[model samples]
Target chain A: MRVLALESATRTGSLALVDYVGAPLGAPLNGVRQAAPLREITLDASLQHSEKLMPALIEMLGAEFKIETIDLFAVDHGPGSFTGLRVGMALMKGFAFASRASEASGKPLIGVSSLEALAMNGSGLVVPMIDAHRGQVYTAVYEVGAALRDRRKSLWDGRPKLIEPEQAIEPEKWLKYLVEKYGSVPRLEDNQIHARNVAFLAALEFGRGAAATRPGACHRHAPTLFSMTPRYLRAGV
Target chain B: MFILGIETSCDETAAAVLTDQPLRILSNVIASQNEVHEPYGGIVPELASRRHMEKILPVIQEALDKAQIKLSDLEGIAVTVMPGLVGSLLVGLQVAKGMAATLGIPFVGVSHLEGHLQAPLLEHPEVSYPFMALLVSGGHTLLYHVKEFAKYELIGGTRDDAAGEAFDKVAKILGLGYPGGPLIDKLAHQGNPKAIKFPKGKIKDHPFDFSFSGLKTAVANYVKKIEGGITPSLLADLCASFQETVVDDLIGKTVLAAKEKGIKTIIVSGGVACNSRLRAKLPEAFFPSPLLCTDNAAMIAAVGYHSLKKGKTSPWSLNAMANQDVRFC
Candidate 1:
């Protein structure tokens, strides 16, 4: 299966196309394997995602791969810049809709949580923090087990266990609470949301049969082109 | 040529399909966020953007469905990209670009103001070039000398609040509902326009420029003075007087520009053009239907039809501008 993933939930947006082979249904959880993207482009922070996204995609899809050739579309939905999230989701929705129209079938669309995707950057007691502005950060704590780390060579092996549900809170208050609970907090890393991670995570989900098998079979748990929306944890003003 | 138009510049999530060669509107769909922003007494940018994200696709799909056309049938796409909330504009822009890229069709980024200017052409195709346009809406109040399609020379504009913004503010002050233009217009009919002689907005030296902040304040002060003794009759009178002043201000500047430019044709458009008092007063001028008057996609597609004919297409790098002037090229 081919997956075209987009990560535009932050200033630095990226796009990646990964080719993966899904494991047989009911196979072992870590059976799916993904190759590095056939093409990848990380956009410069100088331009907004709206300005750079299409141009980059056009260049990547130039004469080599048509949009329809990609089997599935993935995007990092929200918990980051509200506008960025919408731009990414809107573009993905457009592509997915076009794909569906051309094939006359359901084009599976996977939405990865921006915070959860960020957690994949680290292992073991991971706390991914995205600068939510307004002196607050969108964050969540996840416990990445050693078993998942051992199989990281393949697909993003296992879903991180949620230690704390995602939220928007002050960094100082969150850090103070973390110190009292775990003695020493995990290393804080800068936000580096990559589309490759989004693709890998979506590939894992597809292998686990989270996607629909037939046309118009999308349910609440599975997101379709029409059903995907940004996960803006913070309420609008 | 069949063109798809998308507009999410403000509280309205609108889409339409238009075809040229004897221009006609196949479908114009709009999903308004009035109820979402009604509690805030005004449009909150974040909320508007959020609502637009939720409704953009369904609205576009409806537009195509109502027109009985498929996405592949569209030859071009046009979307409002400037003079709007950045978050809201991005939602529409990205979708338009995505569809265009996927279909391998050309798309153009339209200015919101330009979309309003082309609205008259959808109905009054007889209204020729070199006409004067008075655009009055929640976001802007400006007069333009439209030499031709995509050729515009800005003449005058509001210095403080847009004419429709003033209406909304005054409506809020009067304890009226949101979108003050229609509310005040409906109430004004029951009361006498001569009941309260409100001061007309005037600018020094710049006779065509408008300043409605003074008028908004004056209405607020009057309502405060009569705080305890308010009645429906008094509220009607207040709405009537305020609407009269705005209509007068809009007409005064528009007429001045028309006379100075020797332009006989006047096109009135935008949200405030729905005001009955304005429509009743400016009977000679061309006014689009109430649906066309407000922010809708048909006008944008109309502009796109003309623009695409001229081989004017935007690059994929085109980005949304929160505050960009109308481009004549």
Candidate 2:
């Protein structure tokens, strides 16, 4: 079974294809970091996501991997870029909808939380930090749940929060936030944007048969998408 | 004819199956992700879109299954494709489009806000045209002069931050919690709304295009001053106070607008519409069904049915939109 995954939660968008055979993707796919159970499609942090996302996906679907043979689909739900999420979700929904339109068997869409995806990159104390404007950040702390044979386990320990830049008690606070919050903190290595983690969570969910499932919501079953904006829960939307 | 409907304008992932000629909901399954969003205090678009993706198929399945209908059992699929979160919007649009094509059923897109505007019909059934409609939600707060099913005259709306957004931000600043509307609604039940007279901004007889940003900031500054720290009761009082002002303005403007337009029927919906306080305070001149006050897929389906009957089906290539100022006609 081939798995088509899309990650638009962050500035560096990613798409990965995984197959039961082996590596789910091939070269000619730009932004592709690692290949295999996880193939990362990286992009410029500043480039237009709409411009390159489809072309790369078509390549992966047509030449790199056979999308027709996929059994399920996966995508990221955000704690990342607002515009990116919209673009990515729209595309994923389009592609998935197209598949269903052809009288093909419907593939349940898998949604992995972006925060959880960031946590999957194997850090003992992983902080999946997304930049919220001002001197604040959206963060969820995690303890590695399980480690991949080749990669690291992306997991978190507690609920996410929108805290002042100074509130990040972890390491260097990305340094950028350090000076804004405190006088000066030693610079720590910037975390390489692990875009593939989005697909990994989807693959992980598929491994556990968690596709097309609903996450618990307060107040009468959460009422669908109208109540799902994480930022709405933050100090402000 | 039986119809399936999909609504993904903002945050709620909704699917409702209903009848066309006579509007009636068969199965309405809405999958909400409020808690996943609770911690952050505001919707993370990425999170919301992901939740939509996860819930879209199941919501459709449940709606269809509840109605005891398969894809082929339906005659048409109606979806909302306008005026919403582009990402969240796409999930519902693409899903509905796909279903229509697969089921060999025609599908059409409905305006997300217009769905709420028409919600009064589901309850009143006899609501006449040329009525006054005030739509309040997290994404929008507007006053419209409704002359017919498809004709609306823009009268007033918030200059900054929708009424619902104001409630959410105020509630959060007061540490009320994730969704401020309902919490504020609950707390307002105990507090004296008249205790604090929050500002009801008037644009000098403009009669339309309301302003809540001033009120929102007013409450924020007031709360910061009174307790010197955000507290529950203070938050509750702020909610009550702010709610009253909004209600006063909404009801006042709506009543006057109704009188001027020679129509009588004030309808409300959106996340903020779910507020019980406003529901009780909206006055008898408006829609009374509390259920009709909140956003739901039934309204979307109803609007979609109207579109279908009018042969206003969107081409399969139709794109999801994010702007509220949409002109489908």
Which ten contiguous residues of candidate 2 chain B have the minimum total lDDT? B95-104
**Segments in model 2 whose C-alpha atoms lie over 4 Å from true places:** A1-237, B227-236, B286-292, B326-329
Tens digits of per-residue lDDT for model 2 on B1-329?
88887887767787888874567778877777878687776678767776776677677778877988666567777777778767777767756654554355677878888888887787677777777778888878888888787887887787778888887877776677867777778888777788788888778768766788898888878866774665666656777888888877777887787787777566765666676766677656555355545556888888877777888777655666677573334
Could you tell me the lDDT of residue A62 within candidate 2?
A: 58
- Model 1 - which docking category? medium
DockQ of each: 0.69, 0.08
Residue B263 displacement in candidate 1 (angstroms): 1.5
| Interface Cα RMSD of candidate 1 | 1.1
Model 1 agreement with the true structure over B87-127: per-residue lDDT tens digits: 89999999988888778789999888898999988999899
